[model samples]
Target: MSFHEGGPRAAQQKDTRSPGTGAGTVALFTLATIMCLLALAATYYFFVRTTTGQFIDESALVRADTIRGRAGRASTEFLDWLPVTSLVIAAVVVLFVTIVRRRWTAAGIAVAACMLANLATQLLKDWLPVRPYRGVQTLELNSLPSGHTTLAASAAAAVFLMVSPRWRPLAGFLGGTFAVASGVSTLINQWHRPADVIAAFLVVAAVMLPAGWLVLRTGKDWNAWDGDGGHWASSRFWVLLPGIAVVVSAAVAAYALRELILGMEVTDSTSSYFWAGAAMIVGTGHFAMVAAVWLFSWAARRRGPARR
Candidate 1:
């Protein structure tokens, strides 16, 4: 008999189907565009006017000093590493999807989306006349959208696209956290203004959402393909535990290293311990939820047989 004979087969077939251009994609793109426009307006209003420019520059300098004082040298260095790490993580995610799941088209789409976003950001930066604060020069060009923010947003979007739906919430949480942290760090480091970071994020999202929709419509089962059905498989339950452990451990170690080895003080008050505790609880709860779902499914299947 064919695999389609079973009830499970029908459900599986339906589950594997792709979603078309939905309201979510449309809304996301629309919002992104609005944000980009708003960012542009903000940049012009604040930077072009002399009085507004002075206020913004003063504010930026104050904010930069606050962040620098709070985070110190180690945090500054760590923030500097964010762009590199984001790129590496995005590359690794795409490589895993292609190599393990054999989803070449999806992987290609991810790469293309990232490249397009990066290229768009660079082009916008070059074309725009927004300038940075220079003591002698008054204003310097080529500082519209921050490249670090663009890279962070693009990388997060790529990772979100490649992961399974079951893990999407966690992926989103982590991705958003990383993006915000990166943007804030850039602003605090005096590398870019608030408007620049906002513009970069909006542009990246604008490119990625449509790209995600196109990838999804291409008949790829992004979620169903378990990663080789091994211990390292991309199950939501398994991923949460290990992913949290790794993130928490890394954060704690970095904090410790900064304090002891580098003689740097973290004045954030809420250090690695707070984050670690939160991660552990959230991860454990998510795992429990997945276990409950599996149990419910199994129970329903068993009851059906007995009724028959």
Candidate 2:
């Protein structure tokens, strides 16, 4: 008797993934989330509680005045534009990707994470204690995890989540640049200190890492793609370039710190401290983006055909 082989064969082919498909992804993301939280706490402890940290932070703010000019006005304009820009990025990217790819669950998770990150920032701002007397002249108010920086970074992360793995590297890099620029703009405008911006980066990372893990798990079909070089956006350069930026910025920041430590005759009007703060923001934002790219790439399955 001839038997039709289509039914069982099709069923077998329907699912090739094992039960423990994304366990490693989950564990890695959990560890990353913990790291982000710990980094945020350390930021607060160092920049808010310690005397030397307070001095460095306040010095950056003071040095900001020395750069006030056309550049400052440009930064002010960018700051004014930040809220609208953030909303537009999230709304447009999420809606377009969702409608096109029909990624309803991914979109929902991303939007939710973005909102949660922003809300968490506001809550932290209000609930955190006032900067206590650390024997350094500085603002007494609490401004950890800057509101604008949180909004910008989380919005970028939302876009990163909506895109397929093939496009994530490019998206992550561009989004990182935008977030870093927003953070630096806040500093250039003297609206928030460097620590606040870095804290915002950590907050977005902590919130989005789990959301990314969920995306990889649920959207496994779309998440899998050919390994890097399949597309220009998927190229390793996207990650490597950001890593290079982190290294260069770190070096600049280190030089600035060394100068300060050696008791160099650096005046308040000098731009060294401001540059150092900007470098720190650039390094931190890009580092977070790079980490996200690496973590998601690791979790996402490679060399798989799209499953219906």
Per-residue lDDT over 133-157 for candidate 2, one digit per residue giving the tens place of the 0 to 100 score: 9788888999998999999999999
Regions more than 4 Å wrong, model 2:
1-15, 18-20, 260-269, 302-308
Most lDDT-accurate candidate: 2
Worst 10 residues of 2 by lDDT: 299-308
Shift of residue 12 alpha carbon in model 2, Å:
13
In order, candidate lDDTs are: 0.55, 0.86
Best by TM-score: 2
Instruction: Give the clash count for each candidate.
Output: 0, 0
- Runs in model 1 with CA error above 4 Å? 1-12, 15-17, 21-58, 131-142, 223-308
TM-score for each model: 0.60, 0.91
Please write out the lDDT profile of model 1 over residues 260-307, one tens digit for every residue.
346556333433333332232233223322332232222222211110
